[model samples]
Target chain A: EDQVTQSPEALRLQEGESSSLNCSYTVSGLRGLFWYRQDPGKGPEFLFTLYSAGEEKEKERLKATLTKKESFLHITAPKPEDSATYLCAVQAGGSGTYKYIFGTGTRLKVLA
Target chain B: NAGVTQTPKFRILKIGQSMTLQCTQDMNHNYMYWYRQDPGMGLKLIYYSVGAGITDKGEVPNGYNVSRSTTEDFPLRLELAAPSQTSVYFCASRRGGTTDTQYFGPGTRLTVL
Candidate 1:
């Protein structure tokens, strides 16, 4: 069975603090790994998509790195505006079928 | 672009009631999906459509049904709403191919009593 797990169910960091969230997965083949940020009362917003191991992508204060078995989302100098739930999902399928397995997500709060 | 949009941002239903959650996208995405998110849990797929006239069941579909009559509209129907069905529903759309970014709507918070 394919599985995706994220560590540290919740985290609190001081403003300007930097931290990283982990998303580990086990699947037969990894077509892609997705990262999303969701704010309260809103749907998740797309962050990045890593297609293969050793690939990394960054946007503003967020950076995402992917490996064969795990992925990491690093937040640099996080502010209160960056506080939200970070979700990870894996796309594993073939022959045109899509199976998106999502992690429980990590709720982060950056205090000012 | 309107991206993906879902109607009834918040709803309350009594047991045994039925309702339809409307989802529409304007990005010409060939793929549309319905998911339910519980508190502290990840989003669970309810149904998905690859294109018009093609719909399939997903991870959690016991109480949900969907129809995709066009590329822009994919609605999910809940029969006999139950307390366990209370959740925040999200509708998303993705472009063709296997690995495209999915754009989601604001989501609808449903509560069943």
Candidate 2:
């Protein structure tokens, strides 16, 4: 069975605070890992995709890194606008399919 | 490119009633998917299609049906609505190949009574 778990279900940070969200998974095989940001009453917005271990991708103040068993989304000097639910998902190998197994997500609130 | 679009942003369905949620993307994406999210829970895959005329069940496909008659549109059908089916539905599409990013629609909020 495949499973994804995210840590720190909720986080509150000061405007300039920096932190990282973790996504650990157990899959038969790993194809890709994705990071997304979702606001209340809206759909998720794609952020980054990391394919292999030791790979990292970044966008603005957000950075995503992946290892064999886990992935991390690091936010540097976050702002109030960066407050949203961060989602982690994985695409496992086999079947050439893109069915994603998603984590429960970490809700982040940045106080200005 | 309008990315992905979903219609009827909100709906209220009575038990046993049926409804179809429409999703369309203009990016010429070859893969499309339907997902449902409940409060405080992660998104669950309902159905997906690799291309036109090809569809398959996902993790939570029990009360749902999907059709991918064209590369641009994928609609999810709820045959018999139930309270458990009340959720926020999202539509996403991805380009061909393995590394393309998946774009998502704004989502539809459904309430079943």
Candidate 3:
């Protein structure tokens, strides 16, 4: 079965603190891994997509790196505005279908 | 361009009542989807459309129906509201591609009583 698991269900970080969130998955074949940031009362906003192992993407204070069995979202010196739930999703290959298996998400709070 | 938009930002429905959640995207995406998010749970796909006039069920499609009459519009219909169905419904779209990122709307908060 294809499934996604995000660790550190909730995290509280002081402003300027750096931390990493984990997303582990078991899929038949890895197609794509996605990261999203969702704020309260709003839909998720796309953050990054990792297509293959050893791939990495970054945006401002956020960086995402992918591995064979997991992915990591590293926040560098996060600010209060960076506080939000981070979601991880994986699209499996060999299914011939369009479906993304998602994790429960990691709630992050960057307190000022 | 308005990436994606959903009507009725919030709603309250009685048990057995019916309502349609409207979703529209001006990005001319050929693929659209509907999903529901609950507390402490991942987003569950309810329905999706590959193109106009084509629709398919997702992981949690029960009690929900969707129609894609045009490429820009896809509406989700709830036949009979249930307390379990109360959730934040989100609409998303993406251009034709296996690895494209999906853009999401603001989402609709539906409450069942």
lDDT, each prediction: 0.94, 0.93, 0.95
Top model number, DockQ: 1
Among these predictions, the greatest TM-score belongs to 1
Model 1 scores what on Cα lDDT? 0.94
Clashing pairs in 3: none
Candidate 1 lDDT, tens digit per residue, A2-87? 99999889999999999999999998778999999999999999999999999999999999999999999999999999999999
Ranked candidates (DockQ, high to low):
1, 3, 2
DockQ of every predicted complex: 0.86, 0.80, 0.82
Q: Give the per-residue lDDT digits (tens) of candidate 3, residues A1-112.
A: 8999999999999999999999999998788999999999999999999999999999999999999999999999999999999999998866444778899999999999
- At residue B39, what lDDT does model 1 achieve? 88
Tens-place lDDT per residue, model 2, B1-113, is 78999998999999999999999999999999999999778999999999999999998999999988899999999999999999999999999686667889999999999
The iRMS of the candidates, in order, is 0.8, 1.0, 0.9
Range of the 10 consecutive residues with the lowest summed lDDT in candidate 1 chain A: A92-101
Indicate the residue-level lDDT of B75 in model 3: 98
Show where candidate 3 strays beyond 4 Å. Answer: none
Pairs with steric clashes in candidate 1: none
Instruction: Pick the winner on lDDT between candidates 1 and 2.
Output: 1
Which candidate do you rate higher for TM-score, 1 or 2? 1
Report how far off residue B54 is in candidate 3 (Å).
0.9
